[model samples]
Target: MHLPFWLTTALLFPVLLYQGKRARKHTPRLPEAQGSPCGQYGEGTPDIRFLVLGESTAAGVGASRHEQGLASQLALQLRERTGQTIAWHTFGVNGIRMGQLNQILASMELPQADVVLLSMGVNDTTGFTPRHRFRRQLLALREMLAPRYPGPICLLSVPPMHLFTALPSPLRQIMGWRARQLNRVYEQLARHAPGDFQYRSYPAITDVSLLASDGYHPSDKGYRAIAEVLACEDWFPDQPAP
Candidate 1:
């Protein structure tokens, strides 16, 4: 049976606070961002501008090269699916929070895009963003990206943190709860968002081997796997599956 929120938080607080230090100690020094020169490939008529925004996953921390990262994998697959050129760009830092992202976008010239894909939330969970604030920032993000793409804005679900091999005991449990709670908010938006905000349900990644040595971020193989799965999803009504 689930304990009351107050009781649960009180019980877990001290242990979780210590585990946070442990998590940092165990994590490997992250690789450089693999988003620059962003995956601009695939040649055909009618170029489709694809934008990937948000967090380290979008910036591709674990993967060694951008080509092996999610952005490139998705870009290649999109090219195959559409039989059109795809120019994909990824913009994000390793530890960005939602509010930071919101501020960043507000100051920049939002690029035009036919399709916009996103990866966020895990950091938000770790960064201590409240659920309601997360929802608000997420909605604000969508509002900003919606008009740029004006076609489909797909938000990938928060990963299942409870299962991560990297996190210790109560930390995993606590983070998992946070991830699940945030996921519920995302799902609600997918169902109710006025326009084409889709909560793309990314497959659950449980295999530790596919993850980076840090045991947190996706490895090259993991990024490729995720990208392949995303490419297969019918992002458009009549678009054929890969």
Candidate 2:
């Protein structure tokens, strides 16, 4: 069954962003320092390199600029809390799926990160990607990341995909069901992964104002909420109340 045009576009958004990078000269570059409240846990030592990989949300799509994305804010928070620097890298494209992410990882030269945060699944469901494929790709990704970093690897749950609300009721129901199933897959994986690999699930904010103009991606406030959850994780401790 073919997904509708908007769903397809949403699924393919990351790829379009990646392809159009040179054309969008206006898009700001990712920040240099990588530490944030959640990101500071890994830095400097063999135990501190931080890498965030996934879709546009991981890339900070709705924010005004790249520096305002989730990865950048997390990095800044880490630096302030830890008094140590963290190097963050993002490999997120707008419409990327798990299979494509696997390919991306294979081709790219990633830093030796102590912590790896993956924000994905939203695109997969939106694209109607097969559940089997999603599971296989994610497992493969874990294997690839585990031997190298051996630290905390968190898989963020998919934020609620309410963009389809504007569609007919039937389509909306189908899309919502698909999205929930994807989130369940993520939740299950996080529960089962060995070692420090963890799953972090946050309630999806439904306030339309928190979303970008596209009515899909998270706005700055949305990204900030995501950062806050990561910060509270035991892996990424909060600074003492000032």
Candidate 3:
């Protein structure tokens, strides 16, 4: 944890608390996208298994169906690029902190995946998780995943909370500050992790229309835009799965 930052937050506690309550009361609660959470796209012999896990966005809260969400959109992009069938799955819970997500994963029998794209940070930021604890939780999650996933683990940087027009002034800035701190933790982990671990940031969405009606999660177009960027990076291995 950053001492100075936490001290500042402590000083602003009452105001932040009030703002948080107000925001919660006013923001519309949108359900996760309704559809099968797993699917296959394209056609080929050797296929790629892609998994998306983390928070609301990973759960497809902003789209009408899983096919229009990040997992499928990303699969489509990869299919177009590699001509290989992309089998994708998503596991995400709204308002889940890193520790909770880790616990849930420990209880599940997940399929082996060629690539893991994880979306995290917002809830942790808002929950005020200590920086060192966040680091430990992330490292633990990596260890748990490495055995099941023999491929790249891409950590998507926390979306810019400051950009969420739904939030009022100081609350938006404060949350954005916390988000940056967690993002730095992710960046540092990626920098030192083994070759398979990587980090990517969502492209800045300047247009308000790109966000869902809630102004928090990304709209379908936003998810597509993000998928385009992730695919263009070409982080997947060149060799076909055995």
Candidate 4:
């Protein structure tokens, strides 16, 4: 027996919505700036310099192009809001872990930056690296960056891992639970950080459509969501012209 077109569509709606919800559940939502307290930007021509250090997310893995990545979109937004020129540099690798990030920071002679945004941890959590060692290395890296960069040092919380929530049933539950645990660890580490460091908890981008086909990184919409959060918080005072 053949099914009516409308009936088939109607029947599929719930399943589709369920799948969408599940996809979103595993994805990270864009963070609200509610918990982040407002801070003053030092006077004079805001010497806005940004150094982004992290893994695939920072490198714009799921994005279609470089300009669509988190860094670029953030730069554009900052410029529009603060009306200050931003000098931004990005040091990202496809699958870098915390230890590797530390080593990279140590070996290279980086340009003096007023702001530093660290976007690591996801790979470390999902990758083979042990959590304890990863946390230690991250803390060390934080200490290292704090002293060197005079301005605000921010840590972008790991976006939700789609792999967990998007999986089938039992595996999804297990992965989702683990993702939350890791996120908590990240928050705790941020709280324990020394010096003028800020932790920005961005909501996990949940829309699967916002993710690239690989289902790992942010799509343009996801990146824009991140930029909106940063812009709302006035993270970058010296933004360049769009």
Q: Which candidate has the top score in lDDT?
A: 3
Q: Which stretches of candidate 4 lie above 4 Å from their native place?
A: 1-46, 162-166, 194-196, 236-242
The lDDT for every candidate, in the order shown, is 0.78, 0.66, 0.86, 0.63
Q: 161-235 in candidate 3: lDDT tens per residue?
A: 887789998899899899999999889888887565689886767687778899888889888988988887765
Question: How far in Å is the alpha carbon of 9 misplaced in model 4?
Answer: 38
Candidate 2's C-alpha runs over 4 A off are 1-47, 81-84, 162-168, 236-242
Models sorted by TM-score, best on top: 3, 1, 2, 4
Q: Which is superior by TM-score, 3 or 4?
A: 3
lDDT of 1: 0.78
Error of 1 at 133 (Å): 0.8
Cα TM-score per model:
0.91, 0.73, 0.94, 0.70
lDDT of 4: 0.63
Across 1-242, the per-residue lDDT of candidate 4 in tens digits comes to 11342355356556645764675687654321121111223345445766777887677666666566777677667766766665566667776788888888798887667778888766665453555676677668766876677554677876555354345553344345445555666677657753545777776777677766546567778888878877676564333333
